[model samples]
Target: MDYLLSIIIFFPALASIFIFMMDNNVAKPYGITISLIEFILVMVLWMGFDYSNPNMQFENTFALITTYGINYHIGIDGISLFLLILNAFIIFLGTIYLNQPNDKNHLVVCLLLLESILMGVFSSLNMVLFYIFWEISLIPILYMIGAWGTGEKIYAALKFFLYTFTSSVIMFIGILYFAYLFFITTGKWSFDVLDWYTLTLPFDIQIWLFLAFFVSIAVKIPIFPFHTWLPHAYGDAPTLGSVILSAVLLKMGTYALIRFSLPFFPDASFALVVPIAILALFMVIYGGMLAFAQTDMKQVIAYSSISHMGVAVIGTFALNLEGLGGSIFTMFGHGIISGALFMLVGMIYHRKKTRQISEFGGLAQIMPKYATMFGIVMMANVGLPLTIGFIGEFFSLLGFFKSHPILTLLAGTSIILSAIYMLILYKKVFLGSIQNIKNLTLKDLCPREMTVMISFVVVIIFFGIYPKPILIPIQNSTQQLLQIMNDRAIKENTKIHLQNSLNKQKTALDTLHIQKLLKEVQYA
Candidate 1:
């Protein structure tokens, strides 16, 4: 298990080199085998993980640049463990489900490269190493979209690149400045996040640095106005690309919010909570309305992602165990739900050569099994109980309600909006009588497709019913993060203010009988 983290990070890239030399016919199976091994390796890491320990485990550091105090430092805690597994799992499924006809081997290579880069992004503790991994990730995704994508593929790819890269450059400047601050204080240089966490700046400096990091994270999270790039990117990318993009890539933003923003700028985070919550609530309602208006099936899912991620962001800024825990849970839940939905859309596209919602109806009459699976996933998308989606959304809203009740109420409307749009989509696509003969000839899920759908269903329902295993570790880490924020808060007033909010929330929950109900659910 020595160097297990590094091995998990680099295995895919090294495997890609060998697979790249093979012909398309054999490359896919070889790639799948490699990805499967990677997945297993991640699971092994999980098996050996110390769940009760909130500190970073599997840590490995090697000095990379002594003069700057940068190193090849990496580790994983509860926050990152599942995301790493998610990256490995999604890419493995994506490789199995891949169906590109041209340059298939190259596409497979791109996926493998993405897997490696993303693994690094999740595990690296050094700011420089994390940034390097963060920037390199854009390349494979760009190639995937431009090379194998649909209409306006090149345009979508370029827009995605410019938006993310330009904003990330700003974040890099922040990182360098942060390191400089550390050096000035300690008389040495360091880009280690753990080191930065212990270095406190004045409120004014914190505000500037927070803004510097927020702009980049917001764009990546694709919050509200910055979200325009997403629809274009998702719409044009191939199925596998869309799957990985929605599943694992977008999370990098929200993850950074927890990993870097909050701990690094506690005073600024406390000061900015209201405005950020406003933006998050606005994103929730606006994205939902836009999704309701989309005629294209894929576009609906794309817009919905904006709304769902908004929920995660709100939970993040809630700045408590419940909120942070719910946010991480939401991230994992949305990843699985959204990725499955995109795959379903891709399946329909492959058969009908179209994604127009009005193009086909009475799909259930022709493809009962696909309809059944789609129905289950659609229910989960709307946060139906006993489905994975409901757990995260419920806890997220509950968490934020404690902090900003009115805003949480507005945010809760997204649940209704999501139900409306998703149900409408299901009714439009699957509930009608066979009107188009073209649809009558469509087949149900094949063995390969069935495997993917079943896997999604099992995970969705299994985790929904029994989420404590995941929730416990997430809460453990979030609690540690909250301690960091508390200990680092520059102003005594900021600490007291946030503590009072949490106390009032606890009292309100107890008075309303909500606490009792939650305990029942937890034990159930």
Candidate 2:
């Protein structure tokens, strides 16, 4: 297990160098092989991982800067274990299932580089190491969108970069400030995150620190108002670009919320729960409404992401075991569902050369194989029972409903809205009369496409029915986190924030002093 996580993180980067040297003809297969090996190694990691143990595993540490306490520390706990596997599997699938033509090996190398950075982001324990990976991951995707994307690719790429990178500078400052705080408290210079978890700042500091981190995470998740960059990026990127962006990249946000935000500022999180929940609810409704109104299929999926990810936000802010666990589960669920849907859309666009829902009429009649598989994925997208999406959303809403019934009810409305919008989109694209004469002549799924598409279909349904494999591991990790937050909250009297917030009560002393002045005057 020693250095295994390092190999997983760096193998793609090393292979990308080889891929860069290879002739164009040989690069794709070699890239696919590297990714598959990476995926298999992660599967091995999963098999060996003890779901019963909630602590970080596969610990690997090497000092890079002894004076500043920057160590190359990396590990995985139950939460990151499954994400590691998902990232590897999706990158493998993204490489194999791509339907584009290429003349140079740049795209291949970039994708591999992107995968390595993502692996580091998920598994890195040290904030400096994590920040390095996080910042570098932006470059590969930036190249992908601008070079290989569609209309206004430059605009989309820049928007995506500027939105995320600029916000992250503030986050980087927060990390350094926290490190400085830790060094002040205990005369040791360390950038370890586990050490910061023990520091309890005043309520006011938590609010400002929480906002600093929130800007970065929100832009990534593209939550509500911060989500303007998403549709343009998703709509402009190529198929595999869209797949990785939607499936994996977006998850980094919700994952950060769980990993850093809550524990770092438990009291502030509790105090702001209602306002944040309202914002999440707004994301759910507003994102879904936009999805319903889209004419382009890619835009539909892009907007739906905003709506879907809001559930994860709701679950997280619920501040309970179920809420935290379910929020993490939703991250996995959204990744799978969004990845498959983007693949299917890519397949459609490959054959039709168009992404408009209006351009895809009678797909069910013309390409039954494609239609059937597509239908199954869309059902999962709509959160139908016996599908992966349903269980995650169910648990998320179920968990949060206990804390704020009204807000949970509002957030849960996305199901009906999503079902209506998604199903309507499906019915329009797949079930209508043959709107275009060329549809009748279109070929169905080829051997390569079926192998890829059907495998994803199986994953969605199998995990949907038997979610325990993933759920239990996620729960194990989340429960440990929940225990920490709970123990801290008890000693800090955290629940008072929630009660005061709800009752509209103020704990601060009156500043106006009108009544005090009158009493003083009367006494005089």
Candidate 3:
């Protein structure tokens, strides 16, 4: 079991390198087979996972560079396990949906490499190790987008690289700063996150560190203001790139927010709750409204991403069991549903060579299979009941309602707005009359595409209706985290109250000193 985790993490890289060396003819088939093997390994890991344990499992450690106390440390708990599963499943599904039938060896290798890096990022326990995988993960994705994507792919790729790279550099400094502080106090240097967790830094230090960390995670989550790169990236990316980006990569930000930021800077995090929540609210309403106005199918999903992620951020900041749990659940649901949406758009664009909403109408009559799948995915995107989307959203709103009822009310409007625009999209694309001659001959979903779409819908309904499978493990993970935050909040507040009391006593003494000084002057 110790090496079981390492096998899961490293096997994809091995397979990728193998595929890279293979001929293009062989690479495509071999890559898909390798990915399936990897997926099976993940499934085995899932079955073996002891859900009762909230702590990291399948833990493995090897000294990579022990001089600085850095090790190749990796493990997973409930919080990351599902993400790992999502990463493998999406890549496998994306592999099956490759655009070109020409078997591009390099592209196959890049996708395989991406799976490796994503796995490493999820399983990494050491901060430096995590950071290394973190930075490496972007490179293959950059290549994936630039090489295969349409319409200004290079620009989108560079934007993604720059946004992530710049943010990561700041985060690196913060990591160094914390490690240095720990060294100064304890005569040791380490980049283990769990090690850094114990250092009680001053409030000022936590604030700066929090911002540095926030910049990196925020850029990935692209939480408002910083989210400008996402639409262009997601819109221009190839179907595989778009699916991977939405399904797995973006969640890295939300995951890191839980693993690193919130726990490390509890005081600063608490101070930030209101402002972040307000920003999240703006994302919900603004993103939804922008999505509503979009004519391009890809752009609609891109903006809708912003809207959905806004709710994720709100749920995250709520800082309670339901909120945190829902945020994680939402992350999982968003990955599955958004991936399907993008893939569906890609299918249409593949056949019709156009994504304009006006270009599509009455597709249902011509392509009932595609329309059926499309309708299911669209409704799921809009958070329909008995689907995965509803559970995450329902819980997130429920959680937010506890803290800020008014903001929750505003966030709830996204529900209405999303349904309106998404349904309008479905009607325009699939229903009505075939207004254009070209639309009459459109093909239904192919076997491979049909399989992928059905898989997504099934997972959506499965998790949506019975979320306990996901929720139970997450509950164990988040409960421990919430308790930690609660304890930290209590301790910090108590310390502040005591400090204020002492300041009041000092003020009384100062007043007495001034009065005594005046009496001495009068006596003289």
Candidate 4:
């Protein structure tokens, strides 16, 4: 337990507390050292991880309520493996790459504590435990934004918190109801997801639970209509907060879809797949249109995240190996691509004191290295051939093509739309006459900045050309997830039983079962 999942989850908080006790000058380096240590430990997890095996690994359990068969459980599977690594690695680079005007101790602590809670979200195997981590993760980001953010910071913080928290309350209700369903069928209570995956619930209940969970994921991913909070949150947050939000936090929604929604309610998932795809198609078009219309660099990038995530959602709900595999890959690739973009934007803002596209021009000549790095990362963002972004989008659209050809065509338009906006952004921001006289003296990327951007480029190119390492580990798990949906579609026996159970009258106590469970958890 000392060196396994618990350490990966708790190490950041431990270091954060210690960092708080240190001198202000010492806190940054101390946080960086601990972050690197955490990164190495994740590498160890990866090295020890049997990539050939798709089952959950390094499982650790602690009893929370043995009488109810609920416990604190955490584990990792192939799908979550590299993401865990990405979370640790990006935060490491973030700590070092940080040149924020302020060197406040509380900011560093907030970032590290965020790392710990995010790790908890990715690792938890129990429903209530996962929900707890999910809820807690929002607090650090709120602190970072409200205390350190710029324009509309408090409003953005509240919007982000309220949008996600309100949606999550729905998900929590779904989870509790799911556990209650288990009790009626099995004569006991349990919140273990692995155990719930084995239960068969009514199709009627699946639809309710599916919508409940979908509302939550949609808000987090901010699919189309639910995306109102993103631009504000991303535009108003600090660089590090924006970076983590783009890189890791958004993926939690898609990851949860794969982890909870697909497995737990296969019939309802299959039933709703098309409508979801249509919504995703709208997301791609709408997000791209908004991005194309933006004059501010950060707003464009923020909206672009919405567009790329639309592709990820399409891939995931394809419910095939290619679709699911591509979705996982997209999460990692988008994190890198978007994270690098935000970092570069931060660098520019640091020097220019502006994020306005109109203010920039002729940076390629002034800052040759930074401009070149921007070209490379932007190309990857546009899904250039032999880049990490291409592999994910290609496979996702390909997977979607099998099941929904027409919708896939509409979704694929994002490819051209993304290029148009991104290239236009490049021309506006990096090419043309030097508009501002003061910009002439602007310095190029320094040594530390190059380390971060160059590292991002190397990974993007190497993996873009050869995605075998990423694809192979996820195939077995993705295939298993696909099978669960297929099985639910054909299993008449369970379906019939579930149908029969739904016909029974709801009791007064049945309505209170949820309330009773809520109280138990409140004092548990």
Clashes of each: 0, 0, 0, 0
lDDT per model vs. reference? 0.89, 0.83, 0.83, 0.86
Once fitted onto the true fold, the runs of candidate 4 whose alpha carbons sit more than 4 angstroms away are: 1-3, 490-524
Prediction 1 global C-alpha lDDT: 0.89
Q: Candidate 2's residue-wise lDDT over 289-318, tens digit each?
A: 999999999899998989999998999887
Model 1 Cα displacement at 323 (Å)? 0.4
In candidate 2, which residue pairs clash? none
TM-score of each: 0.96, 0.93, 0.92, 0.93
lDDT at 135 for candidate 2? 90
Clashing pairs in 1: none
Cα deviation at 132, candidate 4, in Å, is 0.7
By TM-score, the better pick of 1 and 3 is: 1
Sorted by lDDT, highest first, which candidate order results? 1, 4, 3, 2
lDDT of 3: 0.83
